[model samples]
Target chain A: MEPLLSILIGVLVAGAVYLMLARSLMRFLFGLILLSNAANLAIFVSGRMTAGAPPLVPDGMDVPPEVVANALPQALVLTAIVIGFGLFAFALILAVRAFRSLGTLNTDDMRVAEPKEKG
Target chain B: MSWYLSLPLILPFATAIICYLLRDRPSGAWVSVAGSALGLVAAIVLMALVLQNGVVAGQMGEWPAPFGITLVADLLSAVMVLITAITALAVAIYALSDVDARHGQLGYHALFQILIAGVTGAFLTGDLFNLYVWFEVMLIASFGLLVLHGGKEQIDGGVKYVALNLISTILFLTGIGLLYGQTGTLNFADLAVKVDAVENKALLTVIAMLFMVAFSVKAAAFPLFFWLPAAYHTPSFAVSAVFAGLLTKVGVYALMRTFTLVFDHDVGYTHTILLWVACFTMVTGVLGAAAQSDFRKILSFHIISQIGYMILGLAIYTPLAIVGAVFYLVHHIIVKANLFLIAGISQRLTGGSDVFKIGGLYKSSPFLAVLFLIPAFSLAGFPPLSGFWAKYIIVKASLDESLWIVAFIALAVGLMTIYSMTKIWAEAFWKDHPDGIDPKLSALPGRTALLVPVIGLALLTMVIGLMPEPFVTFAERSAAQLLDPTEYITTVLGPEAMQAADPLEVAP
Candidate 1:
């Protein structure tokens, strides 16, 4: 499961890098989403797989009786996912705003902040 | 103990909430100033406590070390927080005049306070994942502040800044994941203890490189700093000043912390890479500044260049070198932020930020010119200024290692820095106004509000410059703490944890 998931992360990252390298700001944003999800998935898989076992202790018990799944990485990934979602949403809106104000979605064309020197 | 650790983080956040509620009123900006003042007091308390106690660590929710969130402050973290509070207070006051009512009504003060909170949290956190959370907090608020004006230029710059920084954020997150998988612990102290137990040293080095790239982007090192100069000049002067002063330094701080604490296993490999990166970051940043004619843009590029010097100190990795790094970090923040604030006053007086378009400042505003000269010359490493001591220490450290080329690069970059500063001085201060107008400081509205922080910070530069004895000593203590973390580790994890990790130690 770990090896397979690693391959999946690789594929996702490859696709993300491709999209991010594009000229359009929209593509770059989509790339960001893909790449962030890959990171989240990487976190999940790296925690190791323990199918169907909850990481909960029974009542009055200080520790679980069985080898439960790793809960820490799940918590971390959950936090990363939420943060990534918020940032992606912000990036998406920024792209919309950039399109409206700058009149282009191409990063090369969006040079208003750093205008080319006039010859 | 926890209260001391949490007060600096809490004041900014509480102020953020209060300022948000008062965002529509004119008093909202005043609330930010009051909040920053309280934060400064909190920082002073924290600094005093850290000075008395070698290293202080507090566990959240009463959970013991290696299992809970820790807020730890050694000498280095204490001073970073102190300087952060000072910069916050200065920038907050400047914001009182610089932020217009419409922008104020847009919740600018709230975002600014939140940014301060995030920065303070980054300086204090003892857990890696917690540091990531704070980074996001800082990044989001910065996103809001960067595009607060909603101009075409702001939006354009925001896109690039957001895109690049998010990539770094993902890389950082990924690195955290891989490291957690390797060690199964996120606490810095725990990692410092357990990393030696890891059998696969090669994989750990790979993870270290992942962290290196991630922090390099944050630090604005060579080949990854395009987003900084592109976006920094697009924001408000207050926002840019704080960003210039605090943001990248957070990256540098993280690099310093992790490299010293957890990743010292392969310093030969890591520090050498950092050595080249620092040299390039310096040359490219200074050269980039030389090519720019805009006021803020030149300062923005110089931020990258100066970051190189701090990284050089880190790369050298000696007791003296770490001292240089710590001193450079403190001096650069004051001088860089002061330069940006002065740029604001120059913009206000001259009605433009382009150095070529505006002039007569020296003839009309000698006081402003004098204020500018302090930070400008200090930045260019003039003797008896803060920058001189900083550059001297870093260059001296490199020469001690007999890395003459690195020392030469450091000196030559300082010279290049003087060229850029003199360019600004010659053009913006000395040359006649292209439109035949005198850029008088007194004529500018809100001149007192604008000039107060600049004067306060300039005085600080002079103090540090003329009286380097105490600061150098303080930096030496901080560097000692960084190079040897036994005191820090014990404070964070208790002596039992340390003894358990090394059973051969004789009981004292």
Candidate 2:
């Protein structure tokens, strides 16, 4: 389980990094999505490859039993997933707007927005 | 009374809902101002409340920390929010007549309020991932506002801004993910308790770098700051004012919070990187400012340069340095916003912010000149003004750290900053214009100018610089908050880490 999780994280990292280096804004968005997924997986796997832990204290005790699939990671991952979705949506919309206006999704095409008065 | 914890989040969200419902109606402009004014008042009251009560926090949706979202308000958060609210209010009033009519001022107002709400949210949120959410909320609204009057330049600028920010968000998300994976917690307080419990410090170092990259991008630090100068001047003065005032500081604040609290001493590699980056950022930003011919553009570059100060303080990692950074952030926010306002007014008179094109402004409008001079000298770190105290604290802190090289760099930066301010003065106020050029009222805005608040902000800057004991005390307490995250973690997780963090708390 640990080895399989590591492989998945590696693949996720590769795909996200590749997307990140792309020239197009859409690709950039995809890159971000890929990166976030990779992170979420890393977070998930970092909890030691748990098969199942509902995160609730078993038998509803005050101090959660030491053996619950580490509810903390799951909670963190949940928050991360929601935030990732928001970021993805925002980026997606921004990409659409840029393409619509700039007539190209290529990052290389976007330039000259600086203070022209400054050299 | 404890529920006032939610007002900062609730108010702007309510305003956002109203904004979407109203769309582009001019009345929406009125709504935005009313909402921000209320927020400003709430924020001030909150500040007063904190002053009286020390710190106040409450869990959201009635969930205890560790299991639910939390909002914590201490001196640091309150001060940042107060500055943000005041700037938002000033800009809201400024937008009425000064803005483009096509958006009816309301559309811009809507985004402006959301941006404020998001910034306030970022500062107040006790959870790390929730901070990411507020950042996105801000990014989307800022994107909308940046293009509210999309000309060729604005479209171009917005593209870069949106692109880089999206990348940063991804980086931030990934960092959160990695952090959660390693510690099995996302709540900052919860994570604080457990992250240090990790057996492998190297993996923790990697996670820390991830968060640093994310925040640095937002803060406009050296390599990551490339997007800022290129895009800052694209929007109108009122828009630029709030953007300049509150946005980047959110990143700086996050850096201060995360490094001091969550990462603690696990930031070895990152600290070296930050120190070098801070110096380079200052030098390059000042150079960028020196080379600029436009007023706003110069200020924009200086934003990067001055950000180095905040980063430098944090990198050095001292209590006094932290105080300096806090002081610098407040001073820079007020001065930067007002400088943008002055640029807007200058253009209103001259149709340009370019020094070469517009001249003899000293004779045209003495009030404008006076307005420009306050922030100008203040920014240049002139004595007896708010800007001086900020620079003094930072330089002194660096010297005490026995960081002679850094202290020298800071002094050089100060001199360079003065040179840039004087250049603007010479070009706009001292030089002569063409024979046929007629100087006019620069459209003295209106009831919307809200001159009282502008004066209040300026006076506040002065008071902060002069009678600064309260602010310094607050800043020190705030800085200490980072040293002892037991309160923060406990505040969020509801004593989950209280007994556990006892030893950790005592050591700091």
RMSD of each: 2.8, 3.8
lDDT, candidate 1, B378-427, per-residue tens: 99999999999999999999999999999999999999999999999999
The candidate maximizing lDDT is 1
Identify the runs in model 1 with alpha carbons over 4 angstroms from their true place. A117-119, B502-508
* Docking class of predicted structure 1: medium
TM-score of chain A, model number 1: 0.95
What is the lDDT of every predicted structure here?
0.94, 0.78
- Candidate 2: tens digits of C-alpha lDDT, residues B1-508: 5567778767888887796677667777778778888888889988888878766787888887766788888778888988888888778777776766577544776787789889999998888878988898898789888877757678778777877787787778778766765665667777777766776778788878888888999999889887888788988888888888888999999998888778875556777788888999899999989988888889999889999998998888778888888888888898888888778777777667888788777887766677788888888888888888888888898899899999899889989999999998888877765543555555454623635445666777778777877777777887777666666665556664566743221100
Q: Tell me the number of clashing residue pairs for each predicted model.
A: 0, 6
Give per-model TM-scores: 0.98, 0.91
DockQ of each: 0.54, 0.45
Interface RMSD for model 2 amounts to 5.6
Which regions of candidate 2 deviate over 4 angstroms? A52-93, A115-119, B267-269, B442-453, B486-498, B501-508
lDDT of 2 at B47: 88
